[model samples]
Target: MATLLFHLGRASFRFRWFVVLLWVAVLGAAGFAASKAPTPADEGFTMPGIESQKAFDLMEERFPGAAADGASARIVFIAPRGEKVTAAGNKAVVERLVHSAADGSQVASAVDPFQAKAVSEDGTTAYATVSFAATADDLTDASKSHLETALDKARDAGLTVEVGGDALATKPSAGGAAEAIGIAIAAVVLLVTFGSLAAAGLPLLTAIIGVGISMTGILALSEAFGLSANTGTLATMLGLACGIDYALFVVSRYREERAKGRDPWEAAGLAAGTAGSAVVFAGLTVVIALAGLWVVGIPMLTKMGLAAAGAVLVGVLICLTLVPALLGFWPNAVLSRGARRNSRRHRRKQLRTENGGSRWAKLVVRHPLPVLLLGVVGLGAMATPVLDLQLGMPGDEAKATSTTERRAYDALAEGFGPGFNGPLSIVVDAKGAADPKAAVATVSKEIAATDGVVSVSPARFNQAGDTAVFSATPSTAPTDTRTQDLVKTIRDERADIESRSGVSYEVTGRTALNIDIAEKVQASLLPYLAVVVGLAIVLLLLVFRSLLVPLKAAFGFLLSVLAALGAVVAVFQQGHGAELLGVESTGPIMSMMPIFLVGIVFGLAMDYEVFLVSRMREAYVHGDAPKQAIVSGFRHSARVVVAAALIMIAVFSGFIGAGESMIKMIGFGLAIAVLFDAFVVRMAIVPAILALLGHKAWSLPRWLDFMLPDIDVEGEKLNRKREVAERVPEPVG
Candidate 1:
């Protein structure tokens, strides 16, 4: 593998222009393909066999138009402060807006709120409903424009009109601003680390190119795969960070070789054979972790995992091929001019015999017990919040105040009740009943009498008169625990309705569906955790060929992941510092966040584990005491880990500005995880554990050793040649 990679690197160097132009062409083609791709409708995050899915499917089968296929918006008109909304004026505004919106191609019908008594007691507020024939995601930009225009028509005469709900929700910001911010921060870090504009720029350029290709692929695949539109932003986050980090590792190694008086092509070949190998293994770990999301069998998560894994794989490819090609174009100036002058003066100066990381490792070696205990206690403190972490979708309460969704949500809550924004749908299958309408009416009255119910609509039967639907509003906010309890209450009340009225009841609506999703996701957490953690352990065991090493690494990784999630729980769930990011209050963590974080953070944790441990293992294999190897290995690899972690943090943090609160949570969670894992777990915990374990950390039983295949991630042959060359002195000179 080393020989093949060496030859590949030389070939790329010899044909650098072709390599560069080929990537350019591929990127252009990807963009064109993405531009031509179709968009998916608003698909629920559902698993086929789950109860929530069963309910949704039954609802759609019995009542197709009112189920998951339709989009509804609430248009609220409130009189300005100190003004009253006259009945006639409110009627005129609602009628005009409804008529205008109903004329849109996408709109199916617009209901006058006045007719339904959707007006506040003080006559200060009124709201109308606009229903779309298609799902929210199916509405085109033109449809939105028309609706906005209609909404604005009611804004005159001291009326403050706003639109909200599935149809009028704001799309996430374009993400360009976030990407730019991340790239700029990365450039500063790279410039400081390399002290060469050209060298620093290479990683950024590689990242952009890689992310461009990956996002294009994600967008192009969305239509066929039913991927969420948010997949592109998520893919971009991972792709750009990994792309830059991969190239940075390879390029850093190449520059080190150049400093040793090796020719550019030789340096490129050696770097490709060594650091390039580590990049491959590390990237594969990430891909494996991401792909494992498919095991959960949720379509949205499955597609997101596949798309993100593809992006990371692209990063690996660019690092292996494109990075060296670009490096070939600027060999001598890869480092600062000052560093080059210093290298010339100390041509025979061997590399560092001791560094800061090694000195820190020595301290750990002396007090491993205390260091390990401290590390555990600190991580445990951070992870305490996970115990209280709630899992559900963030609602309008978490949105920016400037958004129409938030404004409308507030207005509706003030006018009617919090649950007015997310009414529950009661679908009754009444085929078996002698009189279907009577059965539905009996169930509706019974449901309206249930505690916590604010109101229930009269039953509306389908054309067949076999399926009857009622909209029920609760008194609490949709995301509130009380509201979720109301859904359970209604579902549990189905038995009584079936017995008394001979009708089967099912709760199906956005809020009810979200509750079901949250419950199922929580239930699946343990199995998913087992799968991801088991995979990481087994893969690391194969790579390192040491039982204790993989175990130690896995335990430390779990700690880091827990601590990262705890940080998110603090900010987004516990409401600490959430206001800094425009979040007004605490809420449930998004259902998929924990699963996604577990997968992503586990891979990233293993990335540092592989890079740091590979260096230590290489030293130990060649000839060094375990303690010495730990110190030496950590000294050499710490800088790269820190650099990569910083770059990832910057990239992930940039997405906090995204329009969706869920994306913000993901971005913040990932950034904190990287920061905690790289700096705290990798730097402090692993070294302390290794220091305590000593030789046993690398020991494998004879049978297992024989069965396991050797994976040389550091190009052992190259190290041997260098060692042999050093041993053979120049006698004549």
Candidate 2:
């Protein structure tokens, strides 16, 4: 294995240019491909039972230009009290709005006249919609112009207008914007932790490349299989988290090698073999955890599952391959002179502990219960807020991060009856034997009886014989307490109506959608959490050949997540630090956030746990006391872990500004999860526990340790220098 790694290291130096060029070409190709890839905005993937997707697909088929590609744009019009929405107002503002949808100075085509449908029951609430000429996926100059005209006219009209829907929702911001923030944060953190920008940039570059490939590849597939727009952001987070994390593993190894005065490429290869193996294993575990989304039996989850798994796989592969290859090209200057010197200083400083077992191992031998108790108590505090968690399904405006949206929602809620902004739909299908009129009447009476419901509109039959749609107004705005309360009331009452009224109907629209999604998500929450924890444990055990080690890792990861979640729950869920993150108190956690949190948190926690224990295990195998090994491993990997986590936080935190509520929550949850794991859990608690556990951590029975084959981290690095000198080309990154 050592011989192969040595050869691989030598080959990397010999074929440095080939590896570097391969990256440039892959990046170039990805960039070009991404340019052509359509943004999936609002489109979702193949989750079964989400009839909304099917319904929308059918709507698109019926009205080819209206709902085919993306969600039809929702334009909300607001007129001052008692201002008759004049026909002039409708024509000059609403009709004219469809004429100027275009790029700068160039008009494309006006919104198709058939596309504009009047959407108000009375004159007070009015709207004109402009459907895209083609699918949002197939956006063209003509379609752009139509959308622009609609937006411009709405702005030009006397009424306040807001353009929303899935198309605009999926807009990918500057891809580089996320990368830049990630890089900047990574660089500063790397410098602070490892104390070198050059050192930081290598990992940052690797992570960026990985993220690029992930997003492009996922999006490209989205075109074929119909992935969700939300998957785009998810891919970004997973890619960055895994990418930087993998690099940290390699970087720690590289530094460890350099400390021994090894050549740069030699150290890089050593790092790849030593830390890289753990990276591969950890990455696979995360991929496996995310892939469990498939088990949820929902298309939305399935789509997110595939995208997340793909992103993690790409990240892991990049870190293992491209990062090692890229490191071959770094000059000795790659490490700041001080870092090199410190490397030497720290190396000798630890000679007493080198391959001599972890300090944690010794501590565990000295006192096990104290360490265990401390960890449990600390984790208990963090888990406290988790018990108070409430689930909420916030509507469109609740998803907005815009100050304007904020001010508007607030003013609307305060000024108008909350019901005006809370849009809920109750549909009766005659095909299902539901009487449209009777169902509508029953629905209306039920809604009116609901404390928070303020108004129930007369039923509007889209299909005269069987299908009818009716609107309901809650006593509060979409974000208001009353509106959300009404959603719960509607859902709770659904069963009774089904039994008594014999009317089978589905309630949909923004508010009901939120509520239903939240309820359904929570229903399956336990199984998902169990699966994630189980996967992490089983995967780790298979790699380590020790039951205790995997359990410890899982416990550490859970603690890390619960601790971070508690803090955020206190802030966001419990209303402690909501103002700091710029989120309004919604009184409950968002429906999808927890599921998303488990995926992200488990991935990252596994990352640190893997990095830390891999080294500790290595030291234990080399005959060091376990305490000495744990503390030493902690010291060695601590800097890189902290740096990697900080970069993740910086990149994710910027997303809080994206004007999407769910996205911001994801960003915050991830940032907090990483920080907590890197610092308190992995750094302190993990070490303390390991300190208390001694050889029990690495102590598998002779039968298991001897019988279980040791997993090689890096497939033994092959000495391909002789072959590489012949100028063999490298595969694309």
Candidate 3:
């Protein structure tokens, strides 16, 4: 693997312009493809085999073209508290808005508030429903503009008018400010680390190139695979972070080689051989972990994972090939003046004193038990809140306050109940039943009497009179536990309702679909964790050539992940500082967060593990004592690990600036996880535990060791050659 990577680097240098031009051509192709790509709407959450999903399918079949792929807009009109919407002028204004909305190109139909009896009992508020021909995400900007223009008339009439509903809920966010800030911080960190404008810019430039290609690829893939809208944002986030970090690793190594007096081309090749191999392995770990999301069998999550993984893969490839070719283009500029001066100073002094990581390693050697205990205790504290973690999906309420969906949601909640925003569809299969209309009416009446049900609409039978649709509003909010319980209660009555009315009942709608998704995800959580963790263990075992190493890594990383989750739970779920963070309300964590976090965090945590432990193992293999090897390895690898961790934390933390609460939650979770894992687990606990284990940390049974392939990820042979080159004495002049 090392030889292959080295030759690949050498060839890239030999044909540097060709390599650079090839990437430029790829970027051009990606841009052109992106421009022509079809935009796919968000598939949302799905659990295909679940009862709620079955119910949804039944409804779709019975009422084809019934806004199945579209969303309805709510045109809310609120009068002054002292005034009644029933007043002649106020009602007229609302009717005018409704009529205008019905005439809009996007609107399939509109329900006049007066006709639909949608006015609140207090008569201060009324809302009309405007059905659209396409989902909120599928609607073009022109269509939304026309719809908004139509709704603008109500506001022009001196009444408060706002548009809300699925059409507005899934609108694309203008959230690049946070991401831009993240990239800026990353640039600063790189500049500080490299202390040279040219050196620092290389990583940033490479990252942008890679991310650009990956994003365009995602857009193109969405045309066919129907990726969720969030995929592009997430892929960009991971792509930039990983691209810069991977390039940083290789560039740092190249600088180190140059410091040792190797020519630029040779240094680049050697750096690629060593650091490039590690980058490949690290990236593969991340991709494999993300790909594990497919095991959950959720289309949205699966595509998200694939998109992110694909982006990271592009990052890895760019770091290995394009970065080196760029280095070859201007070899002299790769070394900063500060680095050169430091090399001269270091050579003159032949410094003997240990740095912080080495000193910490020595402390661990002296007192392993205490260090290990302290690290574990700290992680345990952070992990405590995870026990109280609740998982459920958020709704439009979680969107940014500036969003039309958020304003509309607030209006609906104030005028009606919170449940008004998420009504459940009760689909009745009255086929072959005597008096199908009466059967549907009986079921509707029973549903209205249910404990959690707020109201039930009159049954609307299909053209065949065999299927009926009844809208039911729950008393609680959409994401509320009681709302989910209401879904359960209604579904539980399926048998009783079926027996009494001779009509089968199924609860179906966005609210019920979300509930079902959560339930299905929760049921599969443990199995998914097992699969990801189990696969990580096997992969780590092969790389490290030790059973204990993989076990410790898997277990410790899981602890770090749990600690991160606990932090999110404390901040978001427990509402400890939610208001300060701009979150509107406390609610359950997103259902898919834990799954996504586990896959992402585990892979990221392993990246540091590979970089740190691989060096330690290299030293141990070269005949250093376990304690000495730990110190030497850490002393060398600590700077890069710290730099990389800081970059990741900055990038992730910046996302917290996003307006959407769910995005903030995910950002906070990832940031916290990286911080804990890198600074706490990898830097402290890992060294202590390995110090305690000594030689056993790398121990494998003789039979198993023989069966496993020997993997030299750090290019030990190249290291040996460099050592020899540095040691050879010049002829006495």
Model 3 Cα lDDT, one tens digit per residue, 575-646? 887887777777889988888788878778888988888878878888989989999888877878888898
Please list the residue runs of candidate 2 whose C-alpha ends up more than 4 Å from where it truly belongs after superposition: 1-10, 21-42, 45-47, 50-182, 194-197, 228-230, 263-265, 298-301, 338-375, 396-404, 407-416, 432-452, 476-503, 584-587, 657-659, 712-733
Global lDDT for candidate 3? 0.83
Off by over 4 Å in 1: 1-4, 15-18, 21-25, 28-45, 68-72, 80-86, 89-107, 132-153, 174-179, 219-230, 342-351, 658-660, 721-733
Q: RMSD per prediction, one decimal?
A: 3.1, 7.4, 2.8
Most TM-score-accurate candidate: 3
Candidate 2, residues 413-501, lDDT tens digits: the string is 44445556666776655345546467667766876687766767777655334555667777666645566576667767878876666
Show pairs that collide, candidate 3: none
Provide the lowest-lDDT 10-residue window in model 2.
Answer: 101-110
Candidate 1 global lDDT = 0.82
lDDT winner among the candidates? 3
lDDT of 3 at 253: 82
Candidate 2, overall lDDT?
A: 0.64
lDDT, residue 27, model 2: 69
